[model samples]
Target: MDLLKKKIQDEGKVLSESVLKVDSFLNHQIDPILMQKIGEEFAARFADAGITKILTIESSGIAPATMTGLVLGVPVIFARKRKSLTLTDHLYSAEVYSFTKKETSEISVSKDFITSDDVVLMMDDFLANGQAALGLLSIAEQAKAKVAGVGIVIEKGFQNGSSQIRERGFNVESLAIIESLADGQVTFKEEVVSR
Candidate 1:
């Protein structure tokens, strides 16, 4: 996790009081080594969960989730932001409003990949408004699956997302938790937030 926090310190850009863009190495252009470390960290954190599958949203979350799935030896399932022609039926869907993009998108997952017997571990690049996490949780709920927990690469600790998910009794493990992104500076949380 120290490596991840350092990466954020070095490459992350603070666009506003609320937005810290880490697209350089996390989302748009990925660093395989960093992602592998992230995978190892997540796997270590959730090692006792008995996870059967990993669920994440498309685009940003794929890289980290896939890496996590690889480490945990579980299948990864990503919810598509836009439904394709090949994916026409038996989909579990939910609306996720992005605070960063300022848009509400419907994310969907196929029922074929998930079932009630599975223990799901959800992962995401960031946790801001709790929408993406909630959407993934909803999809897992639709499948009647037991969620092991959520794994976040970067958590905006100033935001309500972490508390919201925790209020529902879901464990959240974030590699780097930013306490503030104010005045063009990135401030990480001084205290540890345990799962």
Candidate 2:
């Protein structure tokens, strides 16, 4: 994921000591090539997990989830932030506090998309507070689905989210881990060579 790490370092902006704005190529105006590469990376990491579905929250997680689905040849199931007209009555929901937006939001997914027979690989653009991931995990649990793993594009290592998820005993992999964003500087964990 050197390409992504380099792109972030070159174009990403440090909004504050706690935020790294990668809108230039990640969250906003995305680079399709990089996204495909990221998808492949996630697939490779979780290849042995026998993933049957790719789960993600709506908005930021869509692109990454779609790519993962495409690469892994699995269906991408995203949880909607709000109840929509197209949604069915049978659903699994969880409340999550978004640290970035400083607000609480509920994410929901139809029970039909998840089942006890499936193994889910959760993907996301960022992992800060880990609330979103927790919410997804909750939904998976309700459906009795086995969680294969968690794949994050960028994890804020300074935050407690990643550690919290790890403590729960599930495998969590992050492409780029930010050690800190202090002093208006963005520092990332040394790039890991994908095996």
Candidate 3:
């Protein structure tokens, strides 16, 4: 997590008070080594949760989710933003609004990948508005799957996403939480150590 924080500090671009672009080493051009480390960390955090599957959205969430699945020895399922001809009609769908894109899209997951008996762990690249995660959660609920927790790579803490998820009674773990991005500066929420 320190490595990730350092990476953000070094290469992350502050586009504005509400946007921090980490495409250099995260979503756009990925760092496998860092992703592996992130996966291992998520696995460690959710080691005893009896996770049967890892759920994520397409594109950005795939890398970290795949790595987490590898480390946890579980299969990864990603929700598709766009429906294709090959995708079957039998799918669980939900509407999600992207904070960055500022548009709404329907995300869907095949019913064959998830089941009522499975314990699912949701993973994402960023948690700003929590819409994507919520959509994934809706899919899981539709499948009657038990959601163990959510693992986020970076959380914009200034947003209400994490709190919304927590209020819904799900455990949310974030690798790096930005408390603020005011004036093109990144500030993180201090980790509280429990004695």
Tens-place lDDT per residue, model 3, 1-195, is: 789999999999999899999998888999999999999999999999999999999898999999999999999999889633345489998889876787778889888999999999999999998998999999999999999999999999999999999999999999999998988888889987422
Q: Comparing candidate 2 with candidate 3, which one achieves the higher lDDT?
A: 3
Against the reference, the lDDT scores of all candidates come to 0.91, 0.87, 0.92
Window of ten residues with lowest summed lDDT in model 1: 80-89
Q: After superposition, how far is residue 54 of candidate 1 from its true place, in Å?
A: 0.2
Query: How many clashes (backbone atoms < 3 Å, residues ≥3 apart in a chain or on different chains) does model 3 have?
Result: 0
What lDDT does candidate 1 reach at residue 26? 92
Candidate whose TM-score is highest? 3
lDDT by residue for model 2 (86-184), tens: 454798888888766777877888888999999999888999989999999998998999999899999999898898899998898998899989888
Q: lDDT, candidate 2, residue 73?
A: 98
The TM-score measured for candidate 1 stands at 0.94
List the candidate 1 regions with Cα displacement exceeding 4 Å.
83-88, 193-195
Task: Estimate the Cα RMSD of every predicted model relative to the unseen true structure.
Answer: 2.0, 2.1, 1.9
Residue runs of model 2 more than 4 Å from their true location after superposition: 83-88, 191-194
In the range 31-119, model 1's lDDT, one tens digit per residue, is 99899999999999999999999999888999999999999999999888963334557899888887668778889988899999999
| TM-score ranking, high to low | 3, 1, 2
